[model samples]
Target: MRYEATRSRVEDYFDRTATKTWERLTSDAPVSKIRETVRQGRDQMRERLLARLPSDLTGRRILDAGCGTGMVTEIMAARGAEVVAVDISPQLVEIARSRLTPGLAARVTFHAGDMLSADLGRFDHVLAMDSLIYYHAHDIRNALSVLGERTQENIVFTVAPRTPLLMMMWNAGKLFPRADRSPTMIPHAPKSLSRELEDIGTLADLGRVSKGFYISQALEFRV
Candidate 1:
């Protein structure tokens, strides 16, 4: 119930309230100082996650779970991976599809739905960047388990690490007018998350990126 509620809130925010803002933030358009830092951090984190995958991804199948705006989708497809990019927001998914390069578009499929849906089929590698940050630990574990069951190799994901800076930012976000806030990010301690996910796979730390208000820790679940 909690997960469903959060999912609804997330979909609403991205699909209705902040579609234009997100489209701008993820693009070359100018943004505020804090958002610029976030953009930089997200770019760095995407690179970090990609580095963990095979350099030659020819013929590989990858799931870009919660692939907002499809930045990572285009990159993986360019490397010859069949990319399944899914996001909860149809508006974001449409934006992602519109931005796909000519040839690369053939290698990528865009969907607006639950990333963990069985109908999406299996994958060689799954990358869920900043996608699981809003869920509680138990929900996160369940999500990993569902993804892990169908992923043959690796499931790389990011979480909002429990840090003072992030906590402060989270609290500050709550003070915004209720109608203006996005879904609240739930921070997780690495040790606790590992414990929750131990049965799902062999967990490994892929490192973290903390730039200004954007802080996310990458973890790889080796199945």
Candidate 2:
């Protein structure tokens, strides 16, 4: 039930509390220095994740799990990949749809629902950037197991790497009022995460990115 609980918190946070804030952060709009770091870190992480995939994605079917604003989805679609982009927040999905590139619209489908839904069908690859960061290791493993069951080639995702700085931030974030705080990020040691995922796939620590307040580690699961 941890997954469901965390998922609900995430849905609420993005759909209601921070919708506009995220919309701005993911855009070129000017933001505070703290938020700018997050924006930059996310941009770098996205490129790193995309670089792991084939450059020529023609005929590939990809699932952009937690596809916020469709940045990754759009890029993949532009490269000839048919991307099924799913986000927990309906508002975000709508924004993604509205901002989709003209011709690339046909290459992507926007869905506001669980990314793990089998109804969305199988995929050749799955990209879940910063999506699994809120869940505990067990839940992360379970989520990966579900996605892996249908994915053919690779599952690339990210986690908040356990570190002194991130730990301090995690502790400090708890001081915020319940109504204003984002869902708590549960950091994971790469080795521990890998052990939990061993039965699910061959896990690899692709790398980590840290910029000011934002920190995330890219991981690949070969199925």
Candidate 3:
């Protein structure tokens, strides 16, 4: 099943993020204009999320799991946090490295690794914005384990979910009786959170927030 966002292999999906997603997302006439449009408009809605986070990020060690083009990384840096930005794509890392604001760039360290298997050391905070949705079940579980291992105080992440995929799938089955099987348009109900992301932190509901143009739920856990 392929997601239209980057149209990459589920195995090599992270690698695709290294390409022209930056310029492509920032431009007006980009091919994936619909997705890019929502992301550009994401700034306004990010306020509620920021309010739910620590008051000051000054001197805090942060990990941006899938830093992409450093969009949110800029905000963390502006707040005086030392950021370690990692992405699966070298191209995206290169762009982020070049686009850095000298001061922020100096504070940021970049790495390219698969979140599913990377061994990032613990930090004051760990973040994986809208990136984790690419992972299915086991991958999500593994990511939580890694996050728990690396966070000293908190872990904040977002997932774009609507009801649950099972219900959505049932509805689609009724609507399109003869349609062929295809990729999922959404994710499933999390059977467990407290159990899965346990031991290392205290979990809090960051509540619902917007992503790109879509509504999503943000979850935070303190280590």
Candidate 4:
């Protein structure tokens, strides 16, 4: 599928499955072992992301790109950071807004739009967790360039690793599509992301989080 078509499909899928996705990300409600394992992995990723941030985020500005259901947004707000949370799926954005208390909501400004194209102004940091796996290589570069421009300190994002085993699993998923039709996974290499940061005159700090049934890589760009 073309990039635009894939993007559209992803948006539609997320919009329709927003509730289920939220549960999968942040719920301990009874589930199969595989589903529980995936949740544990996601929790590890969240912990790693939080650990990489500054020790004190008080009064700092943050951009929570692809802030589905505001999991990271809520945590940042609790730390006294001002957050601008944006998501492409309006349904997910709505759920995020609903989850926030009035005080926490006051600390966040939500935008329902594409992170690459949004003029959300600059921030001390940008967090794009588990979101870039949907983009093609060129678009990933573009998104990183935009993020580099809008971040004053660092930009952190996760991508599915383009390893042989993971790639094979991704291909196999295409044979038996999910009923809700999840987006096609576009795995990325750490080297390609590093090169993109170099092209934009930034530094890349890469790290891996391997837990449960998932292994994701995070890239932090410093300008």
Candidate 5:
């Protein structure tokens, strides 16, 4: 599959929204009555993710996969954790670099390359925030294998949620309607994901997670 094509489409789509969209993503919920209405859903999701973080993340070396626009990277950096952030979009890399303060940039290294290609070194936590969803069930399996080669501590997986095909298609059009705009090919089946992890390089197991924004799952691995 032409993964680069899909990356190009998503980068362009967000570039067009860089000014407004990125800020909306990075900031706290607005205070005004009307403005607060917009923050309800995603704000809740972010809180859920925050609550789910491993309790011992402080001072840990972390990998922020698909650290688009660096929102999550900056968060981890603020927590005083050493973070290496990566993304496939050069445009987002540029934006993230420009947006980061020098002090924050010092602790967090932002790279524009495929996580599948980059040797980002070992990290206590490997975070794939809304990332692996772009690839197929097998491609995600392959990515997990690559992660296994790198990190031995734990792997953090955050997806756009797994849902029925009809709902997934509706979401593709509603949330990400760019070039191909449809995530029809990305597998959301639980057994497929479990099987991919089996007999592979990493020891992956099903784990507990609070679901929203398409039922995010974390497959913690010890390699």
Candidate 6:
């Protein structure tokens, strides 16, 4: 249950900060501003992830794993995709459901649970977003393997960068234990992540987004 503790911590953190987290991801403002910069970085990362998906999602089945507030889930559902949105935080899941239009709501199913163990069936595409940041390397591999099993086509996700500068900052942030309540930032290298996905029969396409204290690498794994 090593991951269980991290999962519980993440769930509690998101539950406590769900509204602020949603604004930080969905807001639009000048990037020169510190808060806006972080928001824009997350928005950019999401845009880059969506870019790898099919332009027309009509009838496609997608699993929005760790779908905090349903941002991606709503977008995909609006495009006519049937989406299964799962999150560890019940609070976030409730918020996500509330944000959906009635029509969009019908197209999406919301589940509160760990993506790695969710019995949700297969999908044409699986999106993990920034969810994997809670996991260490071995747990990440396990999660990716589970995602691979459930995905028929692609899996797109984001992870903190493993570079020395970023790692130093990540470690420094840990010195302030309050930040520890936030998701455990287990930074990941693209090369290492790619090898992990390869073992699951997927090839990775990697991209980076940096803003404020957030620097993440987005990986799109094609099956």
- Highest-lDDT candidate: 2
Q: lDDT (CA) for every model shown?
A: 0.91, 0.92, 0.62, 0.79, 0.63, 0.80
- Model 6 C-alpha lDDT per residue in residues 60-137, reported as the tens digit of each score: 999998898888998999988999999988878887888788878779999999787647888899888899886887
What are the clashing pairs of model 1?
Answer: none
On lDDT, the stronger of 3 and 6 is: 6
TM-score of each: 0.95, 0.96, 0.72, 0.88, 0.72, 0.89
Q: What is the lDDT of residue 78 in candidate 3?
A: 84
Between prediction 1 and prediction 4, which has the larger TM-score?
Answer: 1
Candidate 5 residue runs with Cα over 4 Å from true position = 2-5, 16-20, 28-41, 44-59, 165-187, 201-219
> Model 1: per-residue lDDT, tens digit, 162-209?
898888888899889977888999988888888887776778888889
User: What are the per-residue Cα lDDT tens digits for candidate 2 across 49-130?
Assistant: 9998999999999999999888898899999999999999999999999989989988898899999998999999999999
Query: Which 10-residue window in model 1 sums to the lowest lDDT?
Result: 195-204
Task: Show model 4 residue runs off by greater than 4 Å.
Answer: 1-3, 174-181, 203-205
Candidates ranked by TM-score, best first? 2, 1, 6, 4, 3, 5
Off by more than 4 A, model 1? 171-180
Which candidate wins on TM-score? 2
- State residue 78's C-alpha deviation in candidate 3, in Å: 1.8
User: Which 10-residue span in candidate 4 carries the lowest summed lDDT?
Assistant: 19-28
67-87: candidate 5 lDDT, tens digit per residue: 877777777787877889888
> RMSD of each candidate?
1.4, 1.2, 5.4, 2.4, 4.4, 2.5
Q: State, as a TM-score between 0 and 1, how close model 6 is to the true structure.
A: 0.89
After TM-score superposition, the amount by which residue 146's alpha carbon in candidate 5 deviates from its true location, in angstroms, is 0.6
Candidate 4 backbone collisions, by pair: none
State residue 157's C-alpha deviation in candidate 5, in Å: 1.2
